[model samples]
Target: MSAAPFTVLIPARLASTRLPGKPLADIAGLPMVVRVARQAAQSAATQVVVAADDARIVQACAAHGVTALLTRTDHASGSDRLAQACDLLALPDEAIVVNVQGDEPLVAPALIDAVAALLRARPEASMGTAAHAIDSWQDFISPHVVKVVLDAQGLAHYFSRAPIPHARDQAEGQAWWQQAPLQRLAPLRHIGLYSYRAGFLRRFPQLAAAPTEQLEQLEQLRALWHGHAIAVHVTQQAPAAGVDTPQDLERVRALLGHG
Candidate 1:
């Protein structure tokens, strides 16, 4: 498949449940959103913009020399913010847009490029995202860690908070983790990063939220409900976990050193 030009949009929301004002939270002296933008700038994206929901976030971006645009405060999801960003920028239908979360300051640039390339390779897919095998039982059982089951063609069959592809035979004890090894059909922890065609992104919100989407709180389900195929790019490299709480923020700060 031919390479296509792609843009990275980082969605920044100020009101995070675990860490309020998260986008503006300082990480190595720069705001969190700015740090994320800087990481994305290292990617192959033609342009990297922060789809900020607050003026403070935009201001922080400006101070850091990162492009940012103020978006509506009520966007239901990062995908929605990305759609608005796409409209504001007047991106063409064929343009690829990658939604990188503002909290992922440690995200790898290669993963960003890989997801975009995945979408480009599969013209039938409306969007693409990455996933890696679950290595720990805690991650596999944790409701906060969303899991995805993929089909033979690498298209996601379902995404859920529950432990899936149950090793029924090994349910009795600590053997399930060992028995349920990472195979082609084994469960994978879904990485939140996403790549979407500009056209599909614009129409994503129009697809009514599915029952499963609401139950699992996973927006990707809406796409599947609408019969849209989302390509799953399975990567062996596990990405650094994104910051979502005060402890997470401190961990990230420690990793980067306080500034």
Candidate 2:
């Protein structure tokens, strides 16, 4: 399938409680955000731009020859920063904008293409994201691993940290997904990458937080609560881990042959 042309927006913040200046953190000698931008650039996206919370981030991107724009530091979330960026870039309402988190330097280009294509394929969906079938019982029950339940049309029914579609039968450590009735229907692990129409991207900040969102600590629920459909593209492979702490950075650096 041909990947529809889209723009990639990476929201980067300098102040990280876990790793200060994370976006500017070095991995294999390049800033982590710069590495993420480079990976996103490999996709079918027409342009890859960083919506940075600080001028230092902009300067870092410029130094590395990457396009970046400075956004308000006070923005409540990364999505808000991207909303302002959509206006600053003058993106058309119908244009596709994929949100690639700044910390995912090892993100796959194919995943980005798959997500952007969803907007073109499913006009009914207001947004697009990827997920993969859960293969481990441990991950299925882990709160850190988000789970998504999809409808017949592949639209998201709900996203939660709980072990959803709970197997009332699978006790102890049995293979719940391998049960005869669920052989082809395993639970899914939601990937964080998201693609949104530029119009919706800009309006996202105005949506009231959903109760589920606050309880689960997931912002995507706000869109679902406000009656927006998020199409889910099921990928076979799980996504790489995103950096949130110094240990994660070290792991990534080691993987990149710099540690």
Candidate 3:
């Protein structure tokens, strides 16, 4: 069979708590949402669509000549909004659907391809995501940085705010710990990007919210609770910063060398 066509769907909501109307926030002259869609379009996916709950977001996408779908604002997560968008578009069950976060204006096209390709190769995987090795204790311990433990087959075992595979020997100051490969033993930071089969995407909202998911505020946990394997694609480079506040926007602007 031929490779299935993949579609990139960006879930954009205007009422952001950190930065209100964030999708319309100007980034190097263009709105942040538009930049995200443009970056996602560069991926190997067949098409890109912005799933917006507000009319302004739809207008912003239209100004850039990108496809935009109007979804309900009542959806709690971006994944839910994405499923509604897929329904609006009438996508087939076998189609690959990539959920590209709208705040990530600098998201890498290669990373997008990596997640989408992983799902394409693993037909049994219900979902696919990316992760990178955590090099420092700061990132490893930071609750803001979600960490993931993967199984031997590169499938996610667990995702947590706390570090996993604790460095017990390091804490004990064992001589063997000093010689062990500490760098390689660090936990992986889970990237927010994800891809799923259209059929799975539609079924996601119907799945009961897992208790662990509610406690951790991580929706992916629900999949693990449902006994669905999520294949993880480890990447060498780190993903771009998602703009959630003024400081994050400033950092992105500096990276882009905007006036």
Candidate 4:
């Protein structure tokens, strides 16, 4: 099969609960949204565009010569915003579309390529995402960290905030639960980045929210609940932190300066 061109869409919105006007927030002298777009441009994607709702965000992208499309402000999720972007860009059904989060200025180019390539290689998959091994018990228990259970084929079985393959015997202080044998079965931490075929991208908003999705507040669960297969590409490296709060922004700034 011929390689299909991929478009990376950075969905940015000014209104953020943790950090208001986050898209325009300055990080190392540049708006956070523009920084993400710049990093995404390093990928082999055919094009990179900022799908935003605010006029200021549109202006910022224009100033940097980055393509920006104004999407509706009512979109409940970034995936929905990306769908509008696909329509505005006139991407075909066979084209690949990546939804790069605007808040993730530290997103790695290689990770973006991995997700896009996964979808390209698996034509039958409606979506593709990345995951890293869970090394620490702290991360495994953190509700903020989403966990994914993958099948033998590397496709996600489920995603949740709670730990899976629950150690029912751990409550009894079983010595075996802390052994290497049990540690070898550690769960994978789900990364938020995602890529999808234009065909599925266009249909995402139409899918009803699944019960698990609503309970966990995870959008990808809706796809799994609907029986759509999501290929999970495991990577050895840890993904960079997404700037969701002031503290996260400070850490990213420090990393960029030190680099």
> Better model by TM-score, 2 or 3?
2
The lDDT for every candidate, in the order shown, is 0.90, 0.94, 0.88, 0.88
Could you give candidate 3's per-residue lDDT for residues 1-259 as a string of tens digits? 5545799999999998999989998888889999999999888889999999999899888998988989998998888899899899999998899899999999999899889988878877999999998777677778999999988888999999976767764653232222457655557999999999999999999999999999999999999999999999999997777998999998988887767
Off by over 4 Å in 4: 1-4, 171-178
Tens digit of per-residue lDDT, candidate 4, span 103-183? 999889989988999987777789999999877677777799999998878899999998765787675324333578786
List TM-score per model, in order.
Answer: 0.96, 0.97, 0.94, 0.94
Model 1 Cα shift for residue 102 (angstroms): 0.7
Clashes of each: 0, 0, 0, 0
Error of 2 at 190 (Å): 0.5
Q: Which whole-number lDDT from 0 to 100 does residue 205 have in model 2?
A: 92
In model 1, which range of ten residues has the least summed lDDT? 173-182
- Clash pairs, candidate 4, are none
Highest lDDT: which candidate?
2
* Residue ranges of candidate 3 with Cα displaced over 4 Å: 1-3, 172-179, 182-184
lDDT of 2 by residue, 149-249 (tens): 99999999999999887878668676578777786679899999999999999899999889989999999999999999999999988789999999999
Q: Which stretches of candidate 2 lie above 4 Å from their native place?
A: none
The true-structure Cα RMSD of candidate 2 reads 1.2
Which wins on lDDT, candidate 1 or candidate 3? 1
